[model samples]
Target: MKNITILLILLTLTFSNVSAQKIKDGETVSLNGLSVTFNITNKESVTVGGKNFDRYKVSANLVNNSEKSFNIRLNASPQVASNTNLVELDCINATGAKLTSKKMELKLKAHNLNATYWYYNKEGKYVSGVLPVIAGYYLDPGDSVNNNAIFIVPQGETPDVLLRKI
Candidate 1:
């Protein structure tokens, strides 16, 4: 019985360490009975096409926390920001407000025999010009995906992102 107690304590501590690896901001949302959260880390700004934009490095984590494997379709839009301030980074917004969708467009393509996806954006009306916004992810139980995106918002405005089941 003493040995069993020791094993249990070790297991508990192991789990605790795993959970502590990431910071939780209480930004959980329930999608089709699954617990999901989006975290924005490492935000910055850059000038593109004579204008400044907000860029974000983001991650979307889907936790099953259940007995069954769920087949889910997650729509993770990189260019779209959530209406909440959950994923805001401490970066200066050069635009002063969020850029409208018309001012920018998400450019994504699959490479390596369609094994990987690349993300970039075109600023202004010119096709030869490109900005940076890495956005692409899918959903799987106990899986996390990364997306980085640039928003057309000025400083002090954070883009809102959302996840939906389809």
Candidate 2:
């Protein structure tokens, strides 16, 4: 009985550690000289236009946690090639609503890439910009996309921000 209990405890600990390594809320991944932290919140599944889809809202913060100012560009590509299934949602006010009539979709091609620029000025101040992928999609519009963003962090000495799927 004693041996069995110890074996079970060890097995549980090993499995727990391995599972923890997988991406979850508040998990940080390192890229370039920067430490990238991913915080995904409000993940839910909803249906629109007679189709069921998964939607996740995510906020990414790039920390220069290092000693120098850096320039970072955020980018993401769809996992699947189909364009009609991928959509980005826009939020109106505090509530999440599909911005209507307008069609919002992110377009990622093999040749062209989407990029957003961020400048980490002195004193650890972070400034960010958006590279709109899907033009017709809006927050308040009545549509949603089945796509997520892919972040790329370049190799360099400065801090960088990469893309992620939320």
* Cα lDDT of model 2 by residue, 1-166, tens digit: 9999999999999776432112334666543334444454544555556554444455444443445432222234444333421112222112223532111233222233455889887778998766745322122122212233222112211112233222
Clash count in backbone of candidate 2:
20
lDDT of 1 by residue, 1-166 (tens): 9999999999999776432122233377664455556565666876667776665555555555444543322245334422211122222232334452311111122111122344454543423434444343223345433334444555455654434332
Per-residue lDDT of 15 in model 1: 72
RMSD of each: 18.4, 20.3
| Candidate 1: regions farther than 4 A off | 1-26, 71-152
TM-score of each: 0.38, 0.30
Clashes of each: 15, 20
CA lDDT scores, all candidates in order = 0.43, 0.37
